[model samples]
Target: MNNNTVDKSVLNTASVKPKVLLDDAPLSKFHIKIAGLTFGAHFTDGYILGIIGFALTILTPQMGLNALWTGLIGASALIGLFIGSLVLGWISDHIGRQKIFVFSFILITVASFLQFFADSAIELVLLRILLGIGLGGDYSVGHTMLAEIAPRKQRGVLLGSFSVIWTVGYVCANIIGIYFADSTNPDIWKWLLASSTIPAIIILLLRIGTPESPRWLESKGRIEEGQAIVSKHLGENIVLDRQEIASDAGFKLLFSRKYIKRTVFNCIFWVTLVIPYFAIYTFLPLILESFGMSSNHSTDFLLNIILLVGAFLGIYFTAKFSRRGFLIWSFVVLAAMLGMLALLPSTMTLLLVAVFGVFTLIMSAVSNLVGVFPAESFPTEIRSSGVGLATSVSRFGSAAGTFLLPLSIANLGIQSSMLILVAVLLVGLVVSVLWAPETKNLTLNRASKD
Candidate 1:
């Protein structure tokens, strides 16, 4: 449509609040189906990005890559992610979620498979960028679809599961990387890079039955079609939480007075969280070795497992606490951890390990809300666009950080790098305190209005 997307979904949503079937619906197989589809997509996401750190270790010497080339190769996928999530997210909002949702993995699968033939550093970077484009698009559409359809009571856990599964996939990649570390074969990196295709294929196949979000359908004023899907899939008695009459909506609507604040607010939290995360994790083995904490990869392995466990814990906290409370406190705790790490002496290895573990744990927990917050922060017409905007902004920061991290280590030392991270987290903490809205227990329509 046009830029006139003045949502009426929230108008009558406050009335008959107790009788909304979707808000009260219990967990069912249909929900599991959708959840599984997202899980596979996220798992592939983790595998693709996570394996690169290790693969690059083997590829670096063989390919004769310098710091600049290494940084460009590493940051390329995230750069592609910045472009893909921004453009495709708006497209999904206008047309539909499932088409992009299913098609994304196809790009991921093909690009991943093509990595084996890459000869030059630039060629490999191009392949990774292609994979990231698919990944970024899926990030916007996959989370949006799940958020819209999840039961209100279990929304936090269902949506937050994205973080948990992602960590699991990342951990699995680490395990495989560790196994491959023992091989003397020079070309092992190609196998590791190309291996993501298997999981990507599986995810693509399982996504065959995913239905489009009924909220998206009805939000576009396709009420009968939306209702038909609801009855055929969910129970006939399950009424949607919001009844939307389609209004004009465009990319410009996201920057309108009503939503520009939410857009900026979500982007701040997302960017600060992901910059440190992807930058640090993508080069985790190298960074840990520099700190003299993991001469044997033991420390790196420990942190990945802990990150996954912490992600699971985060899902609980998302359900257990207020959204605003969780967001503000998580930043507080994270900033402290990183700040302490910056100040602490490197000689204290055990203490460093403990502090690092705590940092990983707390960061993983808070990261869950990244998926939950954006989807809850905008109306259906602009929800994916809003989420994409945040994703694109965050990925830009992540790309820059990932690209610069090794350079920083070379010039500034690990201690100074940690301090810079402390600064970033502090920014997130301040922004969150000033702007984080309480969306807990509110319906999507109501939450977006906040």
Candidate 2:
């Protein structure tokens, strides 16, 4: 008998008594709450990530920020996200999801309010890092919990909504920025940074009675407790899937031969998608101005509006296509759009803006896959671990990109910056063609293991 096991490997030999186990369970209000909670959490995340871009425009001048300070402020939250996801994400898998679920919002809410009082660039940087850490914990566990609770038939739709929900939050932040943007008000950036508190509090309250993932409990050999929660919330008809025994699912397993390929693939999948997205979006106002367009949040508003529309389109396409096919095709279109942006002079204002809008729409549509693949790729025991590591790695890469974009543009110009991002997209496209899995319709078990 092999002793290495993640959760309930004994279930591999046990028979399920119920006809409708978790995978086939009907969608219920409970599931809706799960989805809603995760969505709200992600929405706050997007707002935090997006609001910094707008706030920095004011903070730079008000605080007299140099390029170095500006990059640190821009990348601070991302670097914090990297740490939070790497550390707390692993802890959640070991300690249980519910604790981290409640604790994250507390951190976010507190950090957001603190932003209103940030007087120096360094103080604001520290506050942003704290905010990012809270979001990092949420990012690690929220999607994992959603995937585990959703019906397999609708899991794609539920988990897939993550990216779009995030985009909507980002759009909302941009809208708010446009509305409150006042060069005369040195205090405007403070309010913008503090606004994140609203969503955090709402999500925290909603999370109060949420149940832990039964599958996670079962994996940890707490079968009766797992059964009790499922039966209590989902009724006796719902049960957990049988898990195979005799495999260690420790974090180290992510680098083992069985998972290393997937670990690398998932990391690459996300890192490429977000690196350019964050870098460009974080400084979008400046980028627009560099293109001889309005930097006064008007053009940014239009781009964000397109992103909002693209988010709904993303929901439809995420549910409609194979994961592998959708990913590869999206990257191709993304690269083409960037190529157009790179070659056409920014002097072609309307044409350049139009191309960028098309790019934003396409990017939003396919970004949904990021939510689905990481959760669906790993088995129950290490699901959050895989997701966390992916989030951590991607945030690190994005932090680098966000920190460097200004420097790159200063040295190479905006067109050259777009071309470098184009190359990044091509690399993702190539990797997707080579290794992206077709897990669109598979059961969580099969998706994770086979």
Candidate 3:
């Protein structure tokens, strides 16, 4: 409870090997349950975020939104996500992951329901910001919880499945968006936004009795409680091996010499990945139109299906290869695809579509890796904070890209914009080669210590 008491446990932990009892524990029903709950949260996040793409299409004409207003409406949630992840992520470290985890879904549900009543653009943007905050909090907390609980051998696959399940949510939203694209009703966007509440409610219900992270408990010197939770999930046969207990260095520690490299890696890689990713996917309808494809809901729906397939491939390969290897190759491939899109003649419809599909596939794979790395890179004491900062920073990039992309396309044209994204991916590829630490098969404790 106090610093003095926590210090005593720190000393005690130093002499022991600190074996995380659940590190190699067999997959159990509890793991599956928790995975389902966390995955549900991700699914909700995807739907909430993805639905905005179509909603904006409908809202723009109805509201007579100019380019600036359109950009602001699009970027509002991402800005909220930036703030939420930065603030709540740090808060979760002190308060506890479960409380933040549960409350976020509640917040999301409330926000989603409120969206149905929004009549003005400002009101809708405000509601979206609130929703984004909840989503940001869930992103950091859910991934950290999953990383802390999963077995090392399967950690990459399990965490990476967040992207796959998120794609399911995205595809579902696209399906619904396509269905409603032709609706003449002014309130159809409201219905689309409000529908996010369904999964959020399910996640809120499922997370009712979820356990706290044992690593977090041990870090706080609540060893007995931590052990009890571990035993409850991993079985009583497991033993706690004491390892060096890093001090509960607060957020300041993220910038300390020991962690600065990891922090930089997380920020740079994540920002680069999300900037083009959010810009491209969030405005896929527009991008398709630029490519001379019919900018119909059907075309957008087909592209998302390709994205889903790519996400599934990402999940499978995340388990099969080294994190560093997969990410390096993925970035290289993504950069190449972007370059091709920039250079190839737009009149080559079949070739352009084929290239774009492969681009979505590889980009989704790398995006899954982006989600996994930040959670794996930090100690339990700062895991949520580290992930939060990375996520927040990435959201900023996404916001900037999403906001300015229309302007960029207007000024620079589609080919030139694609070239710029190609440059961004090349930077990411270099970072992956120079800085990506090998994280596959490492326990949370072991990975953090690296």
Candidate 4:
């Protein structure tokens, strides 16, 4: 019962039996409900994050902002996301996921609506940072909750589907952005910024009465409560053994030899993938314009639709292939696409857009693993913290990319900037092949030990 030493026998049995029980459990309405509710938070987070790109397009001229101010404003939320994921993720490990889950939505909803009242750049930056915190919490808490509740057989599909929902929200934001982009009305940016509140409020209502994660409860030694909840969802005859209870290690466990590999893998891979993604998408309008294509709202909208389709395909493939295989292939393809873009002539405008669309498609597929791998790779006790730390660190890369992308485009030129991203993707591919674990069908407890 020592807090520092896990009962290995329990973990060994847990590695096998619970997976069988969960895999065989009949799919129920509760499973669908949990997936939907947890995914809702991700959906809202995507909207809040994606809408900013479009809002800034208009706000730049209105507020008379410069490049430094523009980058700072764009990176502000990403900075807050870093802090929020690290702090709240650690907090959730001790307090509980449900509390943080509900609180995050409330914070997001309030922060999003407050954007309507902001008249200055500073006010908008502060509010966006607050909104990012809530989104960050959702990244840690929401993904962990879904992984804990999902059937072992379906975890990849369910967790990978998180990105699909995110894509839906991102596409919706772009659609709204396209609709309002040309409005002469001064308040159009305000309306665009505030629109995220609608989804947050609705998702909050849906999640208000949701149950706590059963895996988390079991990890906390609340065996009866955990079993009861699991039985209600999976079936009443199911019985979890005592050995499956995890040792109650604090946040330091993340650095312990048992977990350090996973922690390192998640952090490195996530940063490598997210840097280019945030950099490219955040400046998509500008990137298109620089390529001599129309940077109009309609063009952005069409590209987002392509992204949505690609995301759906990614989710489907996640369910169909090994996690390691899918991810390794994704990195290779992404790197190849970027490399081609960097080397190809800029005068090939139509060819450039076509290649860009393919790049987005592969990127969407690769991104499905970001949330799933971290959530599944850690034990229930440190799942949030592990995920949080990885997310927080990766946000640093995202923030840097978002902040410097304009400068890179200006100084290095599009081709050279893209070459840099190609290098990043290649690094990710190497790390993934060297360290990433295959997590498809493993029980939560078993997957953690990998």
Compose the digit string of candidate 3's lDDT tens values, residues 207-294.
Answer: 8888897878777777788888877777776544444565767788899888888898898889999899989988887888898877
Model 1: runs farther than 4 Å from truth? 1-20
Candidate 1 RMSD to the real structure: 8.3
lDDT (Cα atoms) of all candidates against the true structure: 0.85, 0.85, 0.85, 0.85
Q: Show model 2 residue runs off by greater than 4 Å.
A: 1-18, 245-248, 296-298, 446-450
Per-prediction TM-score: 0.93, 0.93, 0.93, 0.92
lDDT of 4: 0.85
Model 1: per-residue Cα lDDT over 243-317, one tens digit each: 666466766877888877788889999999998998888988777777677646666667877998899999999
Question: What's the TM for model 3?
Answer: 0.93
Better of 3 and 4 by TM-score: 3
The better-scoring model by lDDT among 2 and 4 is: 2
Count of backbone clashes, every candidate in sequence? 1, 2, 8, 1
Cα lDDT tens digits, model 2, 338-447, are 89988887679989888888998998888888898898888777888889999999999999999999999999998889899999999999888888877776776434
Q: CA lDDT of 146 in candidate 3?
A: 87
Off by over 4 Å in 4: 1-20, 241-244, 448-450
**lDDT (tens digit, per residue) of candidate 4 on 1-450:** 779999889887776633335444656788899889888887887787788887898999989999998998889889889988999988888888999989988988999899999999999989989988988888889888888777777788889988889988888888888777789998899999999999999988888977787777878888788788887766765555443666667678888988888889999999999999999998887887776777776677678877888888888888889899999998988898888778877788888788888999989877889878999898788999999999999998999999999999989898889889999989999999999988888777555465
